[model samples]
Target: MDNINVSDPPARITTITSKKLSAKRAQTRIQAFLDDFENRNSTLKGGDKTVTVQLQKLNQALLDESQKRRKSAGEGR
Candidate 1:
């Protein structure tokens, strides 16, 4: 049997402190929220029309915000 010698130092840990969300990250979060809402209401046959409407509105707002960000980025470029 052969003994292997392994003595390697651990890699340094870098901590990132920031309060900014990228467009892609925001979009992903919005999509996840929408998906969660849909999944929760999937089993419910046909009740709570108001809640459904509100969800749709929120989804639209998310889409609009994302589009505005895209437009602004395009303009900047």
Candidate 2:
């Protein structure tokens, strides 16, 4: 071969989103719940409050994030 030229593209970083993190957390929670369900002394009722609080927090955080993204997007116009 006389001559050859080659070049590689620049690397780019990937971003993580809430949806994917939520899915992962859901899977982990299901696994934990299943483990608890198998225990003889497990009281699911006690965890209901905790779960409810967690859900509310997550919901609020997601809503806030969405609102921020919307405002930023609108401002771009």
Candidate 3:
């Protein structure tokens, strides 16, 4: 009789490489900052106009960073 040997497959590994981690951290910090600012000024009346303008600027910055990260990652592949 021949004996058969079986071994478990190698474990799959998932890692958020340093670059991706840094980008995610930056995104979190930006979001938190925006949230805190909004919370502090919640009672200001008619402040939506100013807040909306600021939000637009922040959104654009976030969008640009996201695009830059996507482009960089694509180039790496």
Candidate 4:
């Protein structure tokens, strides 16, 4: 999904803006969010399996976005 540069997003929305985060930093942030979410919503169903699947999806998305950005930059040269 495209990132919206709106000043204020809806309260229910979770916006992840593009930033130059190192792999470690990204992992840390993702882990922190997952932990916080799990803690806040303890009764949530579908344990580790759900989280793993979501992480895999997120990793693939980041890789795809990176490749697209690289290709775009290369084409400009």
lDDT accuracy of residue 1 in candidate 1: 70
The true-versus-predicted C-alpha distance at residue 46 of model 1, in Å, is 1.9
User: TM-score, each model?
Assistant: 0.47, 0.40, 0.40, 0.43
Quote the lDDT for 57 in model 1: 74
* Candidate 2 segments exceeding 4 Å error: 1-48
Query: Model 3 over residues 1-77: C-alpha lDDT tens digits?
Result: 76545575767999866454454466567677777877776756445557646765776677688889899999999
* Order of quality (TM-score): 1, 4, 3, 2
Model 2 backbone overlap count: 0
Candidates' C-alpha lDDT:
0.72, 0.59, 0.69, 0.69
* TM-score-better candidate, 3 vs 4: 4
Task: Give the deviation of candidate 2 from the true structure as CA RMSD.
Answer: 17.4
Evaluate model 3: give its TM-score: 0.40
Clashing residue pairs, backbone N/CA/C < 3 A, model 3: none
Go through the candidates in order and give the clash count of each: 0, 0, 0, 0
lDDT (Cα) of model 2: 0.59
Which portions of model 4 miss their true places by more than 4 Å? 1-48
lDDT (C-alpha) at residue 75 in model 3: 100
Model 4: lDDT of residue 23: 50
